[model samples]
Target: MRWSAGWHGSAGSDRRPAGGRTVPGLREVWTCGWPEARVRAVGDGPVALAVIGECGADDAQLRDALPVVRAEGWRALTRWPGSYLVIARSGETLAVIGDLAGQHPVYYRTDAAGTWWSTAASALAALDGAPVDVTALAAHLAFGQPDVLAERSLFRDVQRVPGGHLLLVGPGGVAVEPYEPAAYAPVGLREQAPVVRAALAEAVAARIDDRPVSADLAGLDSTTLACLAAQRGPVAAVTFADERLRDDDLAFAARTAATVPGLAHHPVPGAPGTVYYAGLDDLPGLPLTDAPNAYVVTASIKRAVLDTVAGNTPGPGVHFTGAAGDAVLSAPSSYLADLLRERRHRRAWQHALGHARLRHTSSFAVLSRARPASRVDLAGAWWQTAAELRRPVRDWIPQAQRPLAWTPLLASADWMTPDVRGLLADAVDEAAGALSDAPARLSDWSDRQDLARVGANTSGWRALALAGHGIELAAPFLDNEVIRACLAVPADERGAPGQYKPLLDAAFTGTGVLPGFVLARSTKGGFNALAYAGLRDNAPVLRELLGPSSHLAALGLVTEQPVADALARAAAGQPTAQGALHLVVAAEVWLRQLAAAPATWWEEVSGRVAAA
Candidate 1:
């Protein structure tokens, strides 16, 4: 019975199917067997709200805004990394809201009985909604698809409220509208750092309330958060390392921990985070997530976090690490492009040189990339749709928060043999169109790309869900306030290749949370060596996972044999695209899950839920 709930009249209990029924006050009867949810009732009036996850502005923060909600008739409490639900009741009206970045997703539908909503997709879909969304499944499996695909959900009948939007579920039925991400007016460069420092500190401070906590120190987000956490009191800091990977994650953590007086840095010996095949055969829930690497790392990462927290830190501690630091902080290569657009040549060139130096690449490469229409890549064009500036697309982008490119992510379609690719011939095109339709800027496509990062939905909510069970984990960098602050600073100030996220560097160094040397240090570690070896070790599992009747191929989204050949080549020591391969492995695993789901709970629900 691992869950978090605060209900009066003892309506609070485990989420297991065997638990008690009805919360007395809630509109819909919740019937499911998931323990990873938090339900808390707050405020006294006809208006009420209850969230099912540990993400939201702190209780006091929400309480302070009550006056405003009453005056305005509606309010969404928090924005950054806050997956919150604000349900307001006035007369027969019910307003349900989700966070700005889809972290705490809210979905709902209306019928003769009024409207119902929740964070869990299937929970609501089971009650009433459309059948499986195959195109969404294909788009999801398409690597590099926009991480946050507007309001579309796995169930066509179940629509989600956008991150910056609100859903009014009332006697009048459902109506959706946008609210947050209020226009950001950039400040002068001199004012940037101080604002960043204040916002970063506030975000970090909000998460450090009294619970014993552990922080990460490998990258800028982790190091800064951990350092700031230390300023308040003693906190355990951690990073992972092993001989196989060149990334000196542990060494970096150790050095920084030594500099900060109250910080305790623990170097956790690395385990094979998991080869693409780690869960090759696993398919957990129905209408599985569209998030990238979700099947690949979600459970393993959760296991690692829980294990680390349980093993060393005393009495259930919350784990905090950098999650959306790159997306939130790194300006797209487009900032320089925007400068070029404005004809600010001198400043653009200066930033370009600095960025080129950071990547250890050429200024030409930076210039070419920065210019949105610089290259017309034919191989991967998801759409011929010109961006807002009518520039051409960027080419193949292999990993997290990359600016939108023309091609489907490399591994997005690679898993299927040619036959399967043809079967789902429009897969890549549909995916590209879907992503392109979302409003984005050339200067911050990567920021929009945050929707798909591994840290976005699955990982954060998993941790939030676990919070109810006394295993609290936090990523202060993902705080809404931190996101707002970063948005205020010009993207160019921090988006250069070598100087990516300089604001973070300057924030800590300026505040003395980290040394000047740390701020000046350019390179961060990479772990390709470890990933390759892990992939090799897990070859057998992968081979079995991709046998003749793969669900992906059966669904006409992938062909089986090419994947088999790829596994063999990877095993034979040929050049491997590790990033793309991970997507293939994970997507296949999800297809397996979707295939297997019907036999279990989904089978019962899928049949009843009709198509749109």
Candidate 2:
């Protein structure tokens, strides 16, 4: 909730450490529930502490841990869980650290005098005095992630700290030390499975017992958690009852919860209207074009579910969700590449095909298609794919040197193989160099390391932001133990025959945590088509907000002729799942939000467009 930006004049121009001299140009502020947040600065060069809100148990633990942290000579130690920004200076060094999970944004830069940092990226842009880059905007408009992170954001000189990392800026140069996950060693699949399963059950049990918490019981992940928790005590299992979200397995949620004696199953129906408008008032300035609306939709669902539960409760409440369940627990083909190395051949083909789809989806698709087969064409495609892979680099770079750099060092780091062991030797060396002054090894192959590296880099930032409203994300499959064990199992055994998540199913067989039908069901639901139907039903709102001259028509976000043809085909009872409708609805909702608040363009537009 707190937002502020400024600069303290240069006090020194020294490069090397002058034994405990105070550094200059650092600022931080916090604004919400963290009432105990305090800042004490006396005989120092440049040091500031700003606390935003009331500290919960987790934050209190961090706060109590800080004196010990400062005693260790650490310029900054931020252990709080809520949104925050901490910038401090000791000598010529300026240390800036946001929440490890990236819920809060802190932008920084270093130059001739010293370093300057702020909570908002745009604030840095305005301070540095640069124009917003339009090419980056075009790329954002075309693909969700930028074509290459080498391109700075529209607001010049501004850069986002990659989630789960800290920034150290000094006269020498700027360095980033990425947080690492703690590694759990390998064991045989059979030997590891039970332990992993038991740990997950334990985690779930502890969470359910924490308070009168309600867990989102979607068909897959949380339902498993609910089944396990229900055996111990009463916990609320919640789900949306919209026909679009109902999927064929909505009944499975009820059936599974019913198996747990005395558990309450709460099903909230998806409300009518665009569903976008209902949530638009809360999130103003969401980009109208070139981004998905999933954030708003999920936020709306979370708000409604929690509000209903709060209405029946007496005080502050805790809610649980399965947001990271899919990413953490379920192995997406891309994230699990190292574990399933045997499928390397098929994976090669899939990656090739995926690359082709991306190529064809872009504006250059037509040009590429018109060209005949040749080595040059093949090489062009390869370079383009590689470029696309490095699109997130800009977010990693600091405020200075953003536009001047052609090499995308940060993006390259992100696309490094998920398994740290497989990282190229040079990259490993570079990472080690960055973490040399850090407290511990940065390249370890552990769960904590993975959580800090892979999880934060990929979905950790997204998850942290969503957890703000007393909601917790549960991912059984992503359980660190389960993943480590799954990784240890040989490829043939893990993927034996026709099963995905083979080892996982075996581990949970006797756990009594999932119904048979739900366990056996492989195909999941897609509420996108339903989302589209809802948006189409509220076409009047779309017209009103978008001025009937919406880019959905102009830029061919949706093709006019194809729309008419598809509708005709659908009316003839043709089986049209039309998943694009979901994307459109999300986009429309975002557009409406932007229409409401046009000033906060970068905050809303940047993320929606940059998301993977």
lDDT of each: 0.55, 0.42
TM-scores for the candidates: 0.79, 0.57
Instruction: Give candidate 2's error at residue 313 in angstroms.
Output: 3.3
TM-score of 1: 0.79
Give residue 34's lDDT in candidate 1 (0 to 100).
Answer: 29
Where does model 2 exceed 4 Å of error?
A: 1-106, 109-133, 137-154, 163-165, 171-173, 181-212, 225-234, 243-248, 274-293, 297-307, 333-382, 386-497, 500-523, 543-612
Ten residues in sequence with the least summed lDDT for candidate 2: 438-447
